[model samples]
Target: MAENGFQGALTYIYDPAILLRLTSFQAEYKNGVTPLNPGETLKLRPLCLEDYDKGYLQLLSQLTSVGDVTREQFEDRFNKMKACDDTYYVTVIEDTTSKQVIGSATLVKEQKFIHRSTARARVEDVVVNDSYRGKQLGKVLVDVLVSLGRELGCYKVSLECKDHNVKFYTIFGFEAGKGQNYMQIRFFD
Candidate 1:
């Protein structure tokens, strides 16, 4: 597989068979878009440059106070993000019928030296389009990300959500505030 393992180094040889399987898997994925509603062909995929201008960021802003970014700003950031193998995987839910990005969630793999060089994954920035709420798209999005985190060999997967959304996320196996407090230090306003 030749992926970046603990200590941030490739510890195995690149397997062509694995690559072929991944290619075939992606081909099947691209062709099979999940239908969520009538006239809406939704599919889940990794973020691509082609999705930059398709209201992807707008959907994200609905989650938090992320200001708008110019196309150049997004391009620069996307380049750096994609360069790091599977460290940052932002999965988007796209309506292929309308070519609109309606939902997104990110799975971040954190390799650690503790716990016998184990790794964990965090899910964040989960949101769905305002018009698409109550369709269970958010649940579908988080489930996909959790599956991905498991495939990445993460020992645990976690996420922090607003108090109101705690119950919503709990159904996905996340313990709501289980003897742990979430604190943050912001470097920017």
Candidate 2:
């Protein structure tokens, strides 16, 4: 596969231009969205194979146990996701100055037959590095995924978070279902 090309897809899933146009930050800044700091360089884009060295897995470890995944394993998973067409959108925010992934999020689109065969999206693995917590990067990540879900024609998007983070998600229009529960069956402990 080419560096910037997908096997048979029309567009690259990790294209930065997608974020530039779909994020709320762009809506706020009609002209263009600038970095968080005038002197610092920050970029919001989709995950790429080279990200393996950019602390991509290290950043994910901050959210959950990433286990010792090798570079080959990372690329294998990435290739599988890309093969699924547009089902997965793993977005990332990089501190270009430091060449490290600072924050990340994923939108997984699920095809459904109930809602007139329309698809729905699940927002998952949203996290920001400890050192970069104060900035609005989290908000930006959520906004980007939500907007991408809509653009993909998903009927609705949902996510699960701890009780403490409920208030934060609410700001992005996520509401807790009255009697809904998030049950999980872990295969490994």
Residue range 1-189, candidate 1, lDDT tens digits? 124211123111111122112211111112223222212467655676767768888888888877868889987888777777658878777787777889888888898898789899999888899998766777767766676667667899988878898877776677765588989999985
- What lDDT does candidate 2 reach at residue 75? 85
lDDT per model, in order?
Answer: 0.67, 0.78
In lDDT terms, how accurate is model 1? Answer: 0.67
Clashing pairs in 2: none
- Candidate 2, superposed: residue stretches over 4 Å from native: 1-15, 23-40
List pairs with backbone clashes in candidate 1. Answer: none
Question: lDDT score of model 2?
Answer: 0.78
Q: Residue-wise lDDT of candidate 2 within 17-46, one digit each (tens)?
A: 555455342323222344322114776778
